[model samples]
Target: MPHDDFQLPEQPRPYVQPPLPPKRHGTGWWIYGFFAAWICLGALISNGWSINFMVITIVVTFVGTPLLGAALFAATKSDRR
Candidate 1:
């Protein structure tokens, strides 16, 4: 076909968009709720109530937080696939 005689089709090209990220669910919600509950409970339990506040905080932060995080991570990771 001659250059002048040949014309490209006027139709639009087909396009595809990338898939969106997975929606947040049990993990996200559980994390937020757990943290919030801890803070509120800690405040109520320690403030003006006991002198063992520091010890309680340490145990919760070091032991509880890690356990909770690990559980959430495992649960979420499995759900991903």
Candidate 2:
């Protein structure tokens, strides 16, 4: 094949930028702090450190925090619209 035999396409494919993530409402830190405080308060109240209290605190801190944060964020975002 000759060096100049092939012709380049006239139009090149457009470059596409990936979509950006949705902006946070900026309350994440506060929500986390609130949940941490709740856990600490629970510990303080449960001086004897019963198993049930410990389990409750663990569940609330780990599972409840994200659920509460999501609910709060959704509520705030919805209000903005």
Candidate 3:
């Protein structure tokens, strides 16, 4: 191609990168929460809802599950290219 060609532009457009996909950590926790709720309900009922056990169950299931989920999700990130 000749430099004097009319079809050629004096400057080319700069390259731009596409944005990354949104993190899925929130959705994953929702799924885990649903299942954990069912399992916790079953266990609590099986134990006849003792006050001490209920307290422990609520804390571990609601608090621990999300913390563990976040750590796992963060550690194993996916690339949605």
Candidate 4:
């Protein structure tokens, strides 16, 4: 067997990720507040009090209110002295 007959395998290069965009501070609260506001608007529009609309309003309020509250809480917590 000739040594020159077998060529050494090429080395693999390390994986590199592209640079990420800069983070936006305090954006979470704005997003959560936006959704929460939409939910409130929906509830207001459904004030006719139909059963289905009432259920939807309740569900959205249940979910959105907590999310908005959490975001607001986080924003305030981050601002503490």
Candidate 5:
């Protein structure tokens, strides 16, 4: 029999950390967007900075650039299989 003042301590469970979440990945589509915006700027310059065309050019630069980038990203993407 063990004395009341002398008892062994219980063993502690080992520390087990949970797994981390997966990282978000991306393809370099904005690189194409920069190229597209540059091309739009060139077009605006060649058109003598017309106001109406300037508006259209800007719309295309912002709106179309993203669309074009997404299209390229989708087209060239390969399956992980």
Candidate 6:
């Protein structure tokens, strides 16, 4: 196409995403939170006396819960593209 021939089409426009969904409080959230805490507590009881057990449980609680929540959100989100 030549520059002289180029023109912008007059069309409604392409859609743009407004934004990521706002953080929501849903039953799913509570469930995940409870499950994470429960696992954390079990870990504490089962291995609280062991240095390795305590470290592993702390790591899982800190890193695992959010990763699980994000995965849940990603799975449930609508595809906009």
- Top candidate by lDDT: 2
Spell out the clash pairs found in candidate 3.
none
Q: After superposing candidate 3 on the true structure, give the runs of residues whose Cα lies further than 4 Å from its correct spot.
A: 1-38, 41-46, 78-81
Q: On a 0 to 1 TM-score scale, where does candidate 6 land against the true structure?
A: 0.42
Best by TM-score: 2
Question: Model 6: how far is 40 from its true place, Å?
Answer: 4.9
With candidate 5 superimposed using the best TM-score fit, by how many Å does residue 20's alpha carbon deviate from the native?
A: 22
Range of the 10 consecutive residues with the lowest summed lDDT in candidate 5: 16-25
Better of 1 and 4 by lDDT: 1
Candidate 2's residue-wise lDDT over 1-81, tens digit each?
Answer: 554455444445344212212335366576868777977878887775798678878877888788887798888667645
TM-score of each: 0.51, 0.54, 0.42, 0.43, 0.41, 0.42
For model 4, the superposed segments whose C-alpha errors exceed 4 Å read 1-43
Pairs clashing in candidate 2? none
Candidate 2 Cα outliers beyond 4 Å, as residue runs: 1-25, 48-53
Please, what are the lDDT tens digits per residue for candidate 5 over residues 1-77? 46643554454434422221121133564665676666667576667666766676667677877787778666654
Query: What's model 4's lDDT at 38?
Result: 62
Q: What is the C-alpha lDDT of each candidate?
A: 0.64, 0.69, 0.61, 0.60, 0.57, 0.61
Better of 2 and 4 by lDDT: 2
lDDT of 3 at 80: 34
Runs off by more than 4 Å, candidate 6: 1-23, 31-48, 79-81
lDDT of 3 by residue, 1-81 (tens): 575785566556354223333455445666566656756675766676667667766776777777776776666555332
Cα RMSDs of all predictions? 10.6, 11.7, 7.7, 12.3, 13.7, 7.2
lDDT of 4: 0.60
